[model samples]
Target: MNPVLPHNTLDQLFLSARTHFKWLPKPVTDEQLHQIYDLARMAPTSANCSPMRLVFVKTAEGKAKLKPALDEMNVEKTLSAPVTAIVAIDTEFYEQLPKLFPHADARSWYVGNQPLIDSAGFRNGTLQGAYVIMAARALGLDCGPMSGFNNAKLDEIFFKGTAYKSNFLINLGYGDATALFPRGPRLDFDEACKIV
Candidate 1:
């Protein structure tokens, strides 16, 4: 069995993690980005169908391509962040299940099933996006995840002629704490969950 994580680790991963909007001028290095994905990829997914694909937008050119897709309120924060990751899902991800889940005929399960493909791709892909955020936080980076963008336009610009589809965006960098708004309250367990 696995040992429970200590307090500081728990705090770093969840208790003190906050959604950041403003970022420091410092950049998130390519090496760190790779490390974040390396960690996140280890997380579980159904049938090991890891469909998440990321496009790290760090260069001026990439950011320009992403600009028009952003909502007005998201424009400034997204542009200022050192890196913005486009978390996406591959509609044809099952093509790789032969290698990713090779022990059995997992690929056959999704080959001709449109509903299954859509459900599994989006569900597992979204889980991987959450893992990306947690992995970034564990690596001492801050994250600002947003969905205030035109998905169709973003897909046309960034994912044309590909099976990949954007699910959301996350601005990544060292955060500027001074720019954070007051933290909000969370629902109590009684309000948010049921203890079977």
Candidate 2:
């Protein structure tokens, strides 16, 4: 078997994660996006309930639908991105927990607990979304994960008929660093970490 990326590889991912507004003329094919999810779904989820949903907006109409939902600054990059994934949470994620956690009663735990469901949905699904960003970078794709979009507008435009609702939007593609801002500051290990 081929070797996996080393510890430094993770640091590379951290280093590489940044806002990239400028894009190259490349297409992220449907199969490629599918492969990305197939690889990412392997990431762990709470009670095996995969609440995170992805909507790859590739067509012009889809991008147009997304524009009014974005804040003024995010409008252009999102439209230019090869693909924009509408990351969302499935409120009825328990329905799938049966299949995902066949050996356990994870589904019942969430059946009527809306608060617990909401917490689990947002927290766990956000983790899953983070996993997708890393998985995409591992696959040699650059990501511009942003949160300037209007969630209400997005939910109406993209999730109106579905139980799923928008969490955030991610612009995916090959990026041009020539247009990137200079690397910003970061917290040192001592400043951000604590061990008991």
Candidate 3:
């Protein structure tokens, strides 16, 4: 069995990690982006139907294209971050199940099922987006995840002619602690879980 992770590792991945709004001037390198994906992609997905696709908006042109889609509250934070990841779901993810889940005819399972296709794509894709945040944190980066955006507009700008659909955005960089708000509270186990 795998041993428990060290305390520092756990802290980095969850406990001490904060959703950052403001970023330091430091840049997140391309190498770091690649490394984040290499770590995140190993996480499991149903039928290995890994539908998540990412567009790292780092350049000025890309950010400008993205700006018009953002809600007023998300505009400045998104623009200031070193990278904003467009966490998207590929609607046609089942096409790759033949290679990703070769042990069974997984691709055939969703071929004609529109509802299954939509649900599975969104579910697994959202999970992958969480993995991306953890991976970034493990690499000592900060994250600001948000859903306040016009998804259709973003899809038009970045994913035109592709099957990918935007689910959310994650601003990534070295964060400015001075800009943080108070940490919010969480529910107790009793409030959120059951022993059944």
Q: What is the descending TM-score order?
A: 3, 1, 2
Write one digit per residue (lDDT tens) for candidate 2, span 126-155: 988988888888777888888998898899
List the candidate 3 regions with Cα displacement exceeding 4 Å. Answer: none
Candidate 2 residue pairs in backbone clash? none
In model 1, where do residues sit more than 4 Å from their true spots?
Answer: none
Q: Estimate each model's TM-score.
A: 0.98, 0.93, 0.98
Question: Relative to the unseen true structure, what is the C-alpha lDDT of residue 9 in candidate 3, on a scale of 0 to 100?
Answer: 96
lDDT of 1 by residue, 19-120 (tens): 999989998999999999999999999999999999999999999999999999999999999999999999999999999998999999998999999999
Relative to the true structure, how large is the alpha-carbon lDDT of every model? Answer: 0.96, 0.88, 0.96
Question: What lDDT does candidate 3 reach at residue 172?
Answer: 98
Residue ranges of candidate 2 with Cα displaced over 4 Å: 1-4
Question: Which candidate model has the greater TM-score, 2 or 3?
Answer: 3
Alpha-carbon deviation at 49 in model 2, angstroms:
0.7
lDDT of 3 at 54: 96
Q: Report the lDDT of model 3 for residue 188.
A: 96
Span of ten consecutive residues with least summed lDDT in model 1: 12-21
